[model samples]
Target: MNVPMLTTDFLDRGVELYDDVTGVIADDGTEYTYAEFGERVDRLSNALLDMGLEQGDKVALVSGNTHYFLETQFAVQQLGMVFVPINYRLIADEYEYILNDCDAKVVVADHAYADEIQPIRESVPADTFVGYGADRIEGDWHEYEDVLQSGAPESPERPDIAEDDDATINYTSGTTGDPKGVVRTHRTEHVHALILAHHMELVDDDTYLWTLPMFHCNGWGHTYAVTGLGATHVCQRAFDAADTFATIREHDVSYLCGAPTVINRLIEEYERNEPETTGDRPVRITTAGSPPPKAQIEQVEDQFGWKLIQIYGLTETAPLITTSNSNRRIAQTDRAADLKVRQGSATLSTQIRVVDEDGEDVPQDDETMGEVVVKGNQVMDRYLNKPEITHDAFNERVEGWFHTGDVATVDEDGMIQIKDRRKDIIITGGENVSSIEVEDTLYDHPDVQKAAVVGTPDDDLGEKVTAIVVEKDDADLTAAEIEQFARERMANYKIPRRIEFEDDLPETATGKVQKYEIREEYWEGESRRI
Candidate 1:
């Protein structure tokens, strides 16, 4: 008999084999074995279904990196309900849009985000609201622990969950308009977990750190992968170098993932603390977003004694299609650091190619730049409720291939290296910032005539969000003034860190601002373009 693929399979395998093994380590100072954790998941899953959450209902999760977030990930999907994890960094209005946009039936959040969610409850209300941990806001909500205990611990109603069932709707940043919800199925998420386990070599002995937010592509699907293998998950409430280092040592963390900006921060913290190095077992970290400069990679490895493995993908593709880790050729050679910064080859079973404007494969000389397109099992099904946009995304260039909107090249060894992004996106600290969003906010300033936003190379953030402008003839707008205007309109990370005012900006004949000219100086010594 052929068993259908489902994310719950991971948990099933863990309970069958590693029932006695520790499954999760929460920063809340609580630990649970596979058997206990599985019971809680069963109870929570039963609770939601018992509380009138029908199959296919959308449940919104709002929180940072915490254990409750991890538990909800498995619970909601047990009965085939769709889980929508919102980014905690978004403003109140953004949260309201996503909550209402997804038509969420339930809103589950931790007390840390009460200030943001408490106000939005009046505007976008869910059928049920649940809060966990201390300091929960005053609202119509039940405590998480109470709910978890209220449900039956035995197996809940199993709704014939299939691989093709609608699983998650991950909302990506909106550069032009409202954020688009990228819809993914169980098959996509299930395969992504397998790929992560295979490439990262996750085993029962590995203790994975929860440095990445569980909201980001379901923590890039590691929640399932690591838990399935019966490996211990060391969860964190926040990302601070001191706390992260303490957790790594405290839990004996073996692996983690983050952007280049995160690695930079860890490196800085490691130097200041001067902690005793990992003598026998070095921590392995996976870095993505803009590839870290080779020098930064070297610094992280040398200082912290952690192996840096780079991977690349977007939230649309179940978050991972390519990785730059464990290449035998690169590992055996002396130039591993240089090769590590390239996004490297496709992940297991993932097919990637660099093609020119006509969709033909670019030469493998690695000099010619082209758009990076890919076809894989893990690609998202489509954008939720946006059929036209989804059709346009795949109809471009190739018939079935998904356009990545990233410019890159393929080397003779078949390794793909990202050169730049075709879309006007600024990836600072691993977060995608739409340049158009920032530019629109800049234009809102009464004194601003023309504005352009671009990424500038920085030692920490990888790319610093920078804005260049052509001020109104008689108006004088300082960098601080522009930044203040932007902060009021957008998230803190989206605000321009550096702003420059000029009499006139270089523009094309059609009156479009040529951002490359403005961005050229800051990136002169850089190896990769945005």
Candidate 2:
């Protein structure tokens, strides 16, 4: 008999098997068992039910890595209500667009970020406002604790949720235009969590630390996987190098996820003041958002004694389709770092192909670059209210597979290495250059702290390869020296013809270099060709 696979199955299993086990450790160090956590979720569901919320309604949350954020996810989803988690780093105008776009009926925000929503509260469609710390917030909001107290702790009446029912809507960064809501169903998220749990080797005895934001693809789907496995969650309010190390020791955190920017901060902190890296348990970190430098990965493993795993995907794809965590392949080669650096082979039941413009799969040469396309259960159902855009995204280049705008190459072992973003690829006079290739070469230089390569408008070469670099402290580097260093490493066309030094490069909330923002500065007058 085929039963509907719902996201609520995770929490149901957790409560049944590990009711007395510690389920969550809040940011402020408060601990709650699975029984207590399940009751709180039921209470919040009843509260929303009393507020006139029904099935197919939307509940938006703006919170940090807190216990309530975890509670809200299950609470709203259990009632067949769609959960919308907004990026707390976004501004008022962005929040306004999202709230109105989703037609959120109730908005639950953290005290620290409630002000951003307060200014535009009246303009949005939301009727009820709830704050985690309502006393500190200026707006007229119901306290989160009071709302839970108002409802009964028993299970609220649940709707007949199907496998295809909408589970959540995660918004893209919208660097180019308005952020698009990626609508995912219960089956997509449920399957993705199972795949992730298997690939990450998650176990009930593991302790997970929340260094990544909960809003980011539902904390990369860890909110479900970690809880479903009956593991402990130690939430950190915000990412701090000192706090990360201390928390790892204090809670014996076994696993966590972060972007490359987070890894850089930890490396810098380790260099400045050496700290104990782990507690009694071994530690493992998963990095994504951008390809991390080899040096950083080595430093994390060798210096910090932590395992680093690289994953690849976007918000639209349930945030995880590939991971470079193969022990079998790594053991066969002495160059484990090289294999670890690549966005390794596809995860179980996922099909990944690097194809040329003609929609034909490229050879596994590891040199010929092509766009990465994928077909998997984890892919989103559609972009909400954007049918035309969704059709174009899926139909473009290939018929059914989702086109991942990332240009990459597949090795003989089917290991895919991302070259550059399709828009970020630099086209000189006649040849195409990968900006990531150039940046990776620059990172090899000891003096180079950070680098971003962009194509600048040029009359002769169509577009000249340019580099914006951040040098190490106390290092006085010259543009000529950098060019000479590039000459020894890469081809003449791939080398940055123009180099500019900067104190620091602009980064996104996830720590990716804002290349589009950097491109806007250089291509002020003329439109960039690529």
Candidate 3:
């Protein structure tokens, strides 16, 4: 009666029930049915086994969104080998640090990025280096296709994997110093997918566009969720507005996930092309990272006629704890635009609490800010080789609750609204200002496009509110005019004292504006970052 939950369960379900259905749409325009994809996974599994990779051994992969990365996920999980998915956007040094940190047994990288790995080839513990889908591979690099072809297509013997067996070691983009690997067991990964599938309404007929990077929290664990439900995966190697819209139209995509940056790009593209909706069916765009502005959300639904399911989480929580799905009642009323801006309620099987510094629950007034802590089966087991950090993550003040490091509020309706990250909150003249609040106001301006707000060191005010603005083409917006716009809408202390126009702002791979990067220049001589 007690069967084990496993990441491999997703693929097994698809193979048994939907073998004939198209499962994957590769970036190269190649298609594979569930049956065909299963066979490929089988081949890769056998090849890994044949090469002496056993359960618990780490297999590292570095690449963009590609079929090879997806296949490696299933194969590595099936054999009970730990999968280390490195962020491709990281530098060669960063990549080397991860490889050495994890002591990867085998390293698989895209051929295009082979140069990055070459410098630290000898230093990494990985014995075998596999390359996929590129010319001019190193002489020692094993071809990904060759390995798949070397083994028989028959399914390999399943390893004795349990629900709690080690699964993935995801490296977070380091904000402090070295990146730490967040370890998730098979159970966590499996349930995280199911929870996501439930909230996103993933069905067999739905097709998901791969706008989010596969490397990011395993595409927010949708890689397993969509695949398990037998939904078609329309993979795009990179996130491009033209290609994304085209993929949606071509594949009749019903669902997708992205951050605010991706949504903004699509909005820009949609305006230029005026592409038709994805038929009469509802398309869900699940956004995470920084919350979207109300105007942006309204424009997405009004102009593009697609639904937005905004979510919030981190790599530590298997990346999903809260989601704001489109509610018909709210959408029917004038409050729909306002609701779109909130992070919504706790997801199914997840417990969320907004607690003050003392670990006491914050009042549900939607104004009292506190840190968001979450508890659920989907939370990661631990940070690999990071006992101290893991211990600190589950702060003892609130036992069993994982501290999220985000400052937010809970409204009367149980909606969790994020004010800002704990570090991003700007303190000017002894008053705290939510960067998100100012950014939302900036988004309201007709001429402004993407915006980011950060605190700049000031002798008089301690720190002054600074704004970085990327304006719409041909729009002559000045710092004074922008400051004037904010003054009318918010407190004078909260309004940006300085504004700088730029072609674009620097963003992390997942679309989050890197405020720390922006602060480097301003705080160069200061001993303290704050």
Best by lDDT: 2
lDDT string, candidate 3, 423-475, tens digits: 98988899999999999999999888899999999988889999999998779
lDDT string for model 1 (1-530, tens) is 97777888887898789999988877887989889888998889988977898899999988878777777888988889999998776778988998888899888888877568778887885868888853457766778889988989997868988899988888875433467898889999999999989988788889888878778778888988998888988888777777887777777788988765566557656656777535346788887655565656777687677888888888888778888786586757697777887888899889998998899999999778778888998999998888988887886988788998888878898888776567556789998676755765676575665667888888899889888887755677788888888888899999999888776666421123456666767778778875
> What lDDT score goes with residue 494 in model 1?
91
Model 2 error, position 526 (Å):
0.8
Q: Which stretches of candidate 3 lie over 4 Å from their true place?
A: 175-177, 326-333
Candidate 1 stretches with Cα past 4 Å from truth are 174-177, 277-280, 424-530
Instruction: Give the clash count for each candidate.
Output: 0, 0, 0
* lDDT-better candidate, 2 vs 3: 2
What is the total number of backbone clashes in candidate 3? 0
- lDDT on C-alpha atoms for all candidate structures: 0.80, 0.91, 0.87
Instruction: State TM-scores per candidate.
Output: 0.81, 0.98, 0.97
**Scored by Cα lDDT, where does model 1 land?**
0.80
User: How large is the C-alpha RMSD of every model relative to the true structure?
Assistant: 10.6, 1.2, 1.5
For candidate 3, what is the TM-score? 0.97
- Clash-forming residue pairs, model 1: none
**Clashing residue pairs in candidate 2, if any?**
none
Query: What's the CA RMSD of model 2 in angstroms?
Result: 1.2
Cα distance off (Å), candidate 1, residue 25: 1.0
